[model samples]
Structures are given as structure tokens and as C-alpha cells.
Target: MKKTLFFASLMMAAQLNFAQEWKPVGSHILTPWGEKVTAQKPHPEYPRPQLVRTNNWQNLNGLWKYAITPVNTKEIPQQWDGSILVPYAIESALSGVGKEVGKDKALWYTNTVTLDKSVNKNNVLLHFGAVDWQCDVYVNNQLVGRHEGGFDPFTMDVTSYLKKGAKQEIALRVWDPTDDGPQPRGKQVNRPNGIWYTPVTGIWQTVWLESVPKTYIVKTKQTPKLDEGVLAFQATVAGSQAGDEIKVRALNGTQVIKEQVGQPNADFELSVPNLEAWSPSNPKLYDLEIQLLRKGKVIDQARSYFAMRKISMEKDENGIQRMLLNNKFTFQYGPLDQGWWPDGLHTAPTDEALKFDVIKTKEMGFNMIRKHIKVEPARWYRYCDSIGMLVWQDMPSGDLGGNHWDMQPGKISGGNRDKARSQESEGYYRKEWKTIMDVLHNYPSIVIWVPFNEAWGQFKTKEITEWTMANDPSRLVNSASGGNFMETGHILDIHNYPDAAMPDPKIFGANQVLALGEFGGLGLPIDGHSWQQKDNWGYQSFKNKTELLERYKQLIRDLTRLIPMGLSAAVYTQTTDVEVETNGLMTYDRKVVKMPEAELNTAHQALYQAPTK
Candidate 1:
């Protein structure tokens, strides 16, 4: 009876602790597109859309055990500090463990999970959406793998370490040197003040597991050509035997476009008769089904989709470079999406929150968004494709070798050209940059590849531009935007402050496309919607929506004159207000829209229509 009573007491305590875990916040805010993000089912869709798998897959999201420890420690602490929501950064309030982890310390995460019998029969791959800096993974007390790099996804095959039908312990150890080390830590500082806000540590992305056969498909490539009316399909296999046949299928809605048999690693072109081209308007995607077959029997299968579209830069009327979508010039204008949320740092609080940003940006009548310095979940890009928005993906900036103040556009101590040559730094940057590009190269909405932004760790600009051209001849390369315009690439970009400024098309030669890479940081601080209380700032401060709207309109009106002079694209400061940075169309909480929707929509529509001849 004493033992039974002790067990009952322990169960009561467990239930009490479960009740106090991190609960969803900000469920009441109606998104900019009138869609409400509620607590019941926030971000319910599959996070990774690029790679689809269907076998022993389980989402290890919801809640996890977490602790903070010294960098030198290798053992788990006796007690967890508390529960935190996975996929959200530690510095975020929604993560429950709102704390800072410096270079001197490490964050540890532990979780116990029971593996399905099916996963043990084959290979089990453990995947992380992203981790801040460095992470070591262990399954069932055995170290499986380790990964470095915060923003990219990494996986480890954990088949050998599993004990079927028994609970397994998975542990992760992470260390991030935000601004303290020479890594690609973008806009993260130990003491986040001004533009640099909050340092993320540990796993700030979804953790999950999937089961695959002995010989399975690893990666698939989809390249669409609208003019040819064909989609090129290629599959990279892991352990395929000789005489293996792979079947590829393309479906539009419920109708099948084409299906054919092909060998692994070989490109197979599938034709679509009545293909509807993908664009900012009428973005249509055809569903793709892939299967691996042995002796005419299907062994494994996966699903993916692709859109038929092509992006290029060509000389338009009067010999000025313009972005050509489907062989025609379409001016791309949208906000500089920083991809930050009030509750979640790297990960959006909910899938609806992720979709809302794209939807709202579209409602503002913008055709494109320059995703600045951060790669988001694949679903974010999928939503952009669905809702008809173009994307210019920027690799997250890091290794600036100094503080945020040191990396500003016009603040270089010397104009000495020799200082730009850093062979060691350049090598490391190229390695990481290639990894980032290879990972996100499949997404269709991503048009422009920006190698460097404002000369942050920018060395050998001309060579890097040449390499980017050789690597990806399909897309346009903006070697460096805003600062240190080398006048080498297809686009001549400039970044201005509160006021919009356009680069001289004549100075860069008549062939270069003039673009305003960044502008319009109009700040309006809501009473409670702020990361900090004092010293909050923006490019241009305003007390009310009325003043903010008037100034924003006038700025766009000034930009209209530059369009005739060869301005083809313009990206505003940001989509949402980040911590301590109040220059956003919406407040940090995403509860308020700072500008009148109609007025901003009218200004953005000017870009969509061709400039007056």
C-alpha cells in the first residue's frame, strides 16, 4: 500500500508540471489578411516541403526537455531548467526558456521516444530543421553525428543505434558563438541592442525522424521550362542496385501530365501539354510523384511538386536591364523580409503566421520580396508560390569580424582596396555559401542569388560573381548590394535610408538594371508591441498612422520618377518590426498594420504596370 500511494503522488506531481509548460501566446491577433491564428492548431502543416518522405515519420516538436550548462560540461544536468517549445529560439518569450547562451556556455536537450517497429527494419534518419551554431546528436547513449551551421538542415541515420519496442533517449548538445566567433552569425549579438537583437542557441527548428529502405532516394531535382513546356526530373539515390528503374509522374490537379521510366541520377524530361506558367499572378504548381522500382515492383516512393517558370535579366526598351519573367519585363517590388516574429525568432510561431506574412505582402500589391539574411522553412516559399509572390533569397550574413556598427554601409574606416583581400575568410565564406545554395536551389520562387550584401565579409567580388555565374547560369547574380558597387553584375543596387535613392543608370552603363535594394523604414511604435521599452528607433519615426502613410506615399512618388530612368526593382526596409527596430509595415506583435492598406496598395501597383513610355 505504501508503494502504491508513492506512485499515485508521483503521477499527481507529473500532471502538475505538465500543466505549467509553455502555452501558445498571441492567438487573438487577426493576421493582416483577416486570418486568425489560434492556439488549437498553430502551424499544423508539414514544415519541410522540399523533401517529402512517408515512412515511420514522427514530429518531435510540441515540447522537449532542455538545460543550459558550461561549455566544457559533457554530462546532462541532474534537473532540466524547464520545458521549452521546440523550433523556437531560447531568447524568444514563447520558448518559455527566455535566456541568453554566450560562447562560454552550451545548451543541452534531451527527449525519450519509442521507435516504431517498422523504423528498426530499415534505416531511421533523425533530422533537425536547423540549429544555431554547433550541435552533437546522440541516440541511446551512442553518439550518432554532429553538425555545424545554424540555418541549414542536417540529418543522421540512426538505424544501428535503435532497440526495437523500447524507449530511446535522444540528446543534443549545442554551442553558438554569436558575434564572438568568426562564423556566419547574422544580426545576433551577445547583448542585442539596436539592429542586433537576441542570440539564438540550441535547436531553433523542428526535430523529427523518418524511416527509409536499405536503398532509397535521397535528393530530387526539379527544373521547369515554360517555353519548352517540360519539367526536368532528376533523382539522387543512396543505395540502389544495378538495373534499377525509377518512375516519375507530373500531375496538374487530378490530371496526370506525363509519366516515364528512367535510371537513377539521369535527367528525364516530362512534357505538359497545357501548362499554366507560374508567375506572381496565376502561380500554378504541378504535383510530382516519384517511385523506385525493382523488377517492376515498387519498393519506395515519395511526393513533390514543381512550378513551370523561368527568371532572367534582359535589355528592355531604350537599352536598360530589366527582370524578365516568362520572356517579358516585370518590375519586382516588395518589402525586405527579415523573417522574424515577436514570439518566435527563427521559426514562425504558427504556420498561419508564416502564411500571413506572404498574404499580407501580396495584399499590399507587391509582386516580390527580398528575403534578407535568413532562410525560412520551405513551406514559407511554398506559400509564396501558392499566393503568387516572387522571392530574392539572400544567404544569411556572418563573419563580419567585428560589431554591428563596424559593418554598416558607409562607415568603413578606410577606402583602402587592399584591406578587402582576406584569403582565409573568403575560403570559409565560400564553403558555407555553397552549402546554403545547394540546399535551397530547388525552390521555384527564388529568382535572384545574392552572394554578398553591403560588403559584409565581401572579398574577391569579381571572382565570386564569376563563380556564381559558372555554378548557376540559370539565375541573375547580384554580387554585392548597396555598398561598394563593383559594377560587374546584371544589377546595380543601392540602399537608402528613410528616403529612397536610385543609382545612376548611366554611371553603371546602360546595360545594368537599376534597383533600390532597401529603403522606407517608417517607424510607428504601438504602446505594448515592442521588444524593449527605451531607446527604440527606426529610420523615420512617426507618432501615428496618418503621418507614416503620408511620408511613405511621398517616398514612392519620388521613386516613380527613377523608374523611367531605369529602376526595375525596389525592396523596402522590412515586412515586420524586429526587436528594437520599429521600421515595419506591421508592429512586432503582428497585431497592427501601421499604414493604410489602400494607400500602400496603390503605390505598389505602380511597379506592376510598365513605366510610361
Candidate 2:
């Protein structure tokens, strides 16, 4: 009877925790998913989908103590503000503290974790999926480490700071200057206007802790060589001994497909008997298992996955440059996805919410998406790879003040002005861009590396483009999109508002793939679903849903015509309405899908059926 009463008490406590709600603190608007959010369990999914471990991890995404303090404050504040929902930026409404931490103030967060035997015995790793600008992390009042990037995940080995059978305290201090600082912030400004949106501050992604063995496989770099029918694997081991061997196995569900064993931190290859290339038509992925063994005993293991895909450029039957998937001519078309939620700024409200956007794009008969000047969590790309959606990722632009915005670069345009950034700012840009590439290099969906957009913070064009191409020769490089037209990249992209238009084939067709990087921003603002109370904008505005659907279909028809004109791909304005921009197929709140899915899908199918010009 005592044991039964104890179990009942525990159940009651769990129910109470689950019932703790967190209402959005903003007046702008709220998404459907926002209402479902709770302070006790926010973004409970495993943060990293690409690199997965079955167990020995804990989610630390519950309510956290947050305080906005002076920028130069070194010590922890004596007073603490109310609880804030983590994984949501402090500036975001979903954070439960819709407070701004400007250049002069730093956002502080503190939390405690009750360590069990499992976490205390093994080497502990604390991971922050992403934190804006700069941050200093502390464990038990000792400075653990510091990170500078806003979009890349950072991990710190906290095994040394662990106290067995005791509560481990974690604290973070974050500072972001927004547009005032020369970082790749991607349309984030203190003031919200036509193009720029609200700023994101502090932690905007998942925070978790994992326990690993003393000697474990830290990372594995997988490169599927489609032409050779072999998968290249490079493993990096931490705390590896002299006799440790790394075992890599590619599995088809439960069946072992291929296996290879090599020394720790070495390279090896596994050949597939019958290679199935990954494409939009058939998205085949092989499950990967990596194990670290010492003295022929399994000491560490990690689960991962990969796809056999090849992306390149080739000339079609008409001698026109085309973007090829698996060495075949397949036109890529999708939206210029900004990846913003009404509740969470840089972060998605939930894992389901993140996957919903990609699923909708695919269901709408799109094969690709141009991820606009913002980076998403790794799981977003994993969904694209799983569901067969191509990605053109843009490097977030910074230092926009010094550059000139060239609306259009006509044929034969050569020399153009470049942004003159400080040496410190330029170094930061190079470091962060390389880091972003390193973190997202494994995903198969990413086909193109776009270094600049609309000439924003464009500097040393030829040099940067060449470097980007050389760094990853496997993927194509789009140096600039709709900016100072340079004759250096694989794809020459142009942005034409409201209608579909490609780069002039006579000049760029011979060398680069002609693509309409952005167009067809047909907008319709639903009366109650709009972000703004009065002012809202789109490239082309409409009154009713019927009118919006008609204009969108017309734009699709115009896009089909461009396919025969050597146009490789086209990106519509957006996936959802963001801030005051009502140009999306869905509204800002994700409550209303502007056009019917079937109608949009039917119109989009015509473009894919067209022959290459």
C-alpha cells in the first residue's frame, strides 16, 4: 500500500508538470503550434538527427532562470527574473520573457541538472545547438568555455566539472549587437521594417547533455561516391588508445548491408553491391553504425545515416547548362524559405513544426528549396534528405551598410563595387562561414553553396567564389544571387519580382545555369491572420484567396515557359508570411494556408513536365 501510494504521488507530480502552460508574451500574433507549447517540455525531440545515440542523454529544455543585466557584468546577478522557456530566444514571445537584450545588455540563463549514476560515470558532453553572437558558459561557477557563432552547434566536455550524486549547475551569458555588430545576422535588426525583422537574442535552439565513454567515436565524415558505388568514411575518435579500432557498418533496416573496420581516426570505404543513387524520385538512405573497440571489445558506439547522391552541372541536349541530380536533368523549383516562426524567431516551435514546412513544400510538388540568408537546425536538412527535397543554402549576410544593392545587373556587366569590411569583421565572416559548412557538410539535400545574396556584404567575389568551389568541389557554387553579376560561379541567378524570369541565356547560358533565384512573390493577407495591424507588404498584393490562387497559377504558367528557355530552377518568394511580408502560401501564424494544396500542386506539375530548352 505504501509503494502504491508513492507511485500515485509520482504520477500526480508528472501530471502537474505537464499541465504547466506558457502563453506567448507578444501582441503581434501566435502560431497554432505556439498555443501547444508548455514550459515543462519545450522542443523535447533529440536535437541532432544526423548523429544519433540510442540512450544516455537528457533533455535540458525546460524552464530556465533568465535575467537581462548590464553588458559588462562579470558575476552572476543576485536577483533572478521569472522562469523563461528555453530553446526560444529571450526576444521571442515563446521564451516566456519577451525582453530585448540589446548591445548594452547581456542575457543570462541558469539551470540545474540532477545527475544520475549513468551521467556521473561516463564523460559528460554539454551541447548547445545554437546561441546568437557570443556566449560564455559556466558550470558550478567555473568557466567551462565560450562560443562565438550564432548558427553552429558547439559542444563542451564537462566531465571534469561533474560532481557525483549532486546537482550540476549550468549558466550562460550571451551578448548580441544585432545589426550594429558586423556579424552574419541575416536580416536581424533592432528596428523592424520592410525587409528586416525583429532581432533574436540568446539561446534559440536545443540544449542537452550526453554521456559518452572515455574513448568514444567523436565524429564520422561520410561521403558517398556514387560513380564508384562506394561510401567513404572517416572517423574521429576522442580518448582513443593505441590499439583501438573503429568499425563502420551500413545497414538496410535490420540487415547489415556493408561493413568495414579501420584504425581509429582513419579513413576507409564500404562498397555497395547494387548502388541506389538518391534523387527526388527515390530517396534511399542507408543507416550507419559506428563502433569504437579496444582489445576487440566494444567500448563506444554511435548511430548515423547517409545517402548516395551526386549533384553537379552538365549541358543538356540543347547544349544549355543545367543543374543535374544523379547526372540527370531535373529542374529544381521551390520557395525562398526564411525559416521563421511567429513564436520562435530563429528556432522552430517544435520538431513537428519544423518538418511540417518541408513536408508541405514536397506535397506541393516542389523538388527543391532555396534556404534564404538564414541557417536552420541540422534536423531540417535531415528531413529534406529523408523526403527527397534539394536545398540551396545561402550564407547569412552581414555588414550590409558598406555594400551597394544592385537591383539588376544587365548582360555584359563586369566590375562592381564590393563591401569594405574591417579586418576583424572579415576574419569573423570567413571563420563562421567555414564553420557553418563544416557542421552542415554531411547532409545530402544541400546541393549548392550560395556565398552572397543581393550583393549584401559581398566582398572579394572572385576570390571567395573560387575558395568555396575549391573547398567542396563535389557541390556546385552559386557565388552571388541577384546581386553584382559576376561571371565566376556555376549558376547565374536573377531575382525578378512577381513574375518568372531567368538570366539572359545569350551571355550566361554558355557557361552558367540560368536560374530565377527569386520571383513570384504573389501575396494575400487574410483579415485576421496578418502579422501587422495595418501595414503589410508583398511583391504583388491581392484581395481574396481566389485572386491569389489565380495569380499564383499564372506565375507557375510563366515559370513553365522559362523551363524551355534554359532556366534550371526558380524559387518563389517564400513558404510562409514572415513579419509584415504577406507573400507566402501560408500565413505568418501558419493557421491559414492561402491557396488550396491540390490547385497549387496541379499548376506546379506543368513546370516539371516541360522539356529543357
Candidate 3:
């Protein structure tokens, strides 16, 4: 009887373990990370690292019952199709319900969260790390707020809808048109192929709750001036009184450099002695502590950091333009870094996974990476700063009209005559461009601002470059990369594939730094780890890792020659394979590193020591 009972118990345990492993019911699937996600403790870390608070807060990740509702539906569906892990996209394998909602429907998410007893005081603020397109939030059936921007974070005050000691139901409705609209959707498309991939909709970021006083700090901006050895700050507050005091402290290791007391919403400068400038070779960061005090009591405090560095353009020995880092020419060679994951789409599965790419890039000996058409989490940039990696930030393109022929590499034959954008579109583009600059202007590692890529929705090249320069004179601007070069801006950027070349920087005579904005897409697909078994392609296809490594080595060898020929920077096609594009150094699942680390690292280090003109 004991033996028979033990056998039955063993069978039950095995069944339970199998149930824990989520399975796919259709063609859609979950990411590898998705399968590992658990609702017991989901994305429990503080969402906003920039601005932090010690008030009542709760993470709303975990499992959320979800359904696909009609775009115009006003009532909640009585039946939920299945459960999805919060923060992961619906198309990801982790979401549990791998399905495509497309552009025609609104994806709805509903979850009930109990308010902690301590959070009953004051106003409760709900925050979202990001949402794809348009999203509306409702708490306990009360409409709370809505946001439009897809990439930027947004928040709403949900104090009025809270019931003390009771469970509050939170509902989110999202609508994303992706390529169907002119919004800055990046490289997302309905029918993804080649460069574009599947669309990310609904909540693709962290969702959490925070309790704050009626008045709080909304945001803060810190800018460093290396020449003057000063760091300038501007603080924005929601409920700041005219005479509110803000205490700022700058620390290096355990030593305090400077401290100052200032008024809210006013410019304050703190001086430092013997400042160490930040660069790709030496990224020096000073820690910051900010406190909001009322009547000599600390109401709120947050920690931040900044780097003191400068990026400028200067004439080289050959009278050609070159990019200067701290008054010295530094050749930047790195990957294009599309910032996509086959399983998570825009979101990476883990913080370590995100840092892995930057760490690997640095290990491979490249000092810079062009963040192509995607804005990574702030942590990614922080890692870059800690590891000393330069970043070229691209303002993701939007309104790229469908016409596959236009995107083809050699479809245009010789370069077609550069054309200008319509005045109306140009006006809207400028407005959005300014917003993007203002949002990302504080990062010191971002040395270059790429306004347009291959002329997609590109117009008024000269004017746009001028505007970027005037708005942020601290950084260099690349007018248009690879397409419709107007001989404007501080960088004469080009795009080459599997081959590296440069235009005559002398003929332009603008003293613009030369860079290859895009190149080197060598694809090799691993059978077990691909988005699809067939139809996978890259700029150049290879059959084996040995052959791919050889081709890569040849490309780097050729690029080294271009460094002395006025090449200041080069961005390799990508870091990982996405969907049907199998040209990444790492596989889509991130489980495999295709090439030997030693070989890739050795090849990458050649860029730093390569002789310059």
C-alpha cells in the first residue's frame, strides 16, 4: 500500500512540473525569456531609476488576464481568452497567449491589485515604462489618463479612484497602427521581412504604482561643461513653492566634490576642481544626490550621475574633417545595433541580457555603437558609460511610405539627385526632432545625432542639420546617412554593405567628419534557433561559421585601411538576428554566440589602434 501511494504521488509531481512549463497552441510563440517568466515576482525592481521616490509603491507586473476587443468596445468582455505576463509583449512567447492583434483591433489588459495599507495616504500615481502607441488607463472603472508617445514614459494620478484596503481593478487599452500610420514606429511593419520585423503593441514596459504628495519633482536635467569644469542643473517640480529648497551633492567614490543649495526651477551650477573628462576611452562619471526639503525635512531624494565630455569637429592633417574626442581624433568602429530581440521585440528579457550586448561589444574591442532606430532602456546607456562605450543615437524614422523598391540597396543604381521634403512635412518633422533631442540631450556618451537614415522621410537636409547644431551645439550632427547627401552637417556619412568605403571628405570642404553609418550584414542561420525555418536572408549569406568569421575578418581588414582615408566611425549592420534576418553576431534567442569570442575581440581591437591620417 505504501509503494502504490508513493507511485501515485510521484506521478502528480511530474504532472505539476510539466504544467509549469508554458506551451504554444498556435503558430505564434513565446520568447525564451517568456517561458521563464513567473507571476509570483515579475519585474519587481523600481521602474524609474532616474527619478526615484520612497513612498508607497507596488509593481503591477505578474499575470494579467487579457483579451482582444473591438476598437470601439466600451464594455469589458465577460470572458478572458487567457492570461499574459505583464510587461512582455503579446507576440512574445512569455505572454502565454501568443497572438497578433494587428492594426485593426485594440488589445485590452485587466488586472486587480490590492493597495498596501501604507499607501492609503495622499495621491497615488500610476506609471508605465512605455506603451507602443495610444493607450488609455482606467482604475476601478474610473477613467484616469491617456498618453500618445510610444517610446517615452508617461504617468497618471490615480488617487481619486483608490479604495483603502480593497483590490482595485486596473484596465489598459492600447492601439498601434505601426507602419499603417506616420508615427515614429521605427522598423516595425505589418508584413515584416528583410529589415523590418513584427509590430509591438499594448504594454511592452513596466507598469507600477507610486504614492506621492500633491506636489513632487516631475523631472530633472543635468548638463556638464568640461572646459569650465562645471555641472549645470535644472529641476522641474509639480507642486514646488517659489522658495522651495533643493540640495544637490556630487560625489566621486567616497569623496564629496561639491554641494549646493538652490531654488526649484532655477539654473544652478556647481564647480569641480581637477575634473576628469569623460570619453570613449575613459568614461568618468560623478555620482549625484538630489533632495527635496520642506521646512528642513527631506520629502524626497533621488540618485543620478553624469559624465563630463565633449564631441566636436576639427580639420585633420589632410585638410579633411575629422571627429574629435577631447581635442583628439578617435576612430569609432562598432555595430549598427538594431536593438531587437526575437522573443521580446522592443523589450529585452533581462537587464543582464541588455548589458550583455554592450559588454560583448566592448570586449570585441569596438568603442562605439550606433543605436539604430531604437531607444534602449536608460540602463543600457548607463552600462555603456560604466564600460566606456560611445553611442551614436538615431532618431527613429517614421512616415516611410511603402515601396519596397526604394529600400533596396542597388535599386537606385547611381545615386539619384537628392530631393527635399515637402514644407508641410518638414515642419512636423522638425517639431518631433526637437522633442527627441530634448528628451535625450542629457546623456554625455551620445556624441552624435543622426537626423535621417537613407533618406526615409528625409527633407530639408541643410535646415535640419542647422537646427540640430543650434539646438545642441555640444554634440556633432550627421545630416543624412547613406542617402541624399547634401554636403551639409559636420559628418559626411555613407552606407556600404559587406564592404567599407568613404566619400571624398575634401571635396565637400565642410570640414565634416567621415563615417560609414551602415555596413557588414553577413547572415548565417542556426537551424534550431530561428524565427522561421525558411525565407531567412541577409545582405550577404554564408554557409558556415568558419566562412562567416573569415568574411568578417576580411571586412575589418578592409575597414582598417579606410580609417586613415578619413573614416571617423563605422557601424556594423547589427548585434543580433531578428526574425527572418540571420546576420547577427548572436542568435535571436541569445543562447548562442556564433563566432569565437577571442577572434571577434581580436578583430575589434584593431580599430582603436588603427593609424589615422
Highest TM-score scorer: 2
Per-residue lDDT for 204-291 in model 1, tens only?
Answer: 7778788888888888878787778887778988889999989988888988878988998889888888888888888888888899
Best by lDDT: 2
Whichever of 1 and 3 has more TM-score, that candidate is 1
What lDDT tens digits, residue by residue, belong to model 3 across residues 259-281? 99888888999887778998867
* Angstrom error at residue 99, model 1: 1.1
lDDT of each: 0.77, 0.85, 0.77
Model 3 has a clash total of 4
Give Cα distance to truth, residue 548, candidate 3, Å.
Answer: 1.6
lDDT (C-alpha) at residue 596 in model 1 = 68
Q: Which ten residues in a row have the lowest lDDT in candidate 3?
A: 403-412
Model 1 / residue 44 / CA error / Å: 4.8
| Superposed model 3: Cα runs more than 4 Å off | 1-35, 117-120, 402-435
What's the C-alpha lDDT at position 202 in model 3? 78
Error of 2 at 239 (Å): 2.3
lDDT of 2 by residue, 264-347 (tens): 878889997677889877988889888888888999888899999988888877777988888888889989999998889888
Our tally of clashes for model 1 stands at: 1
In candidate 1 the C-alpha lDDT for residue 269 amounts to: 84
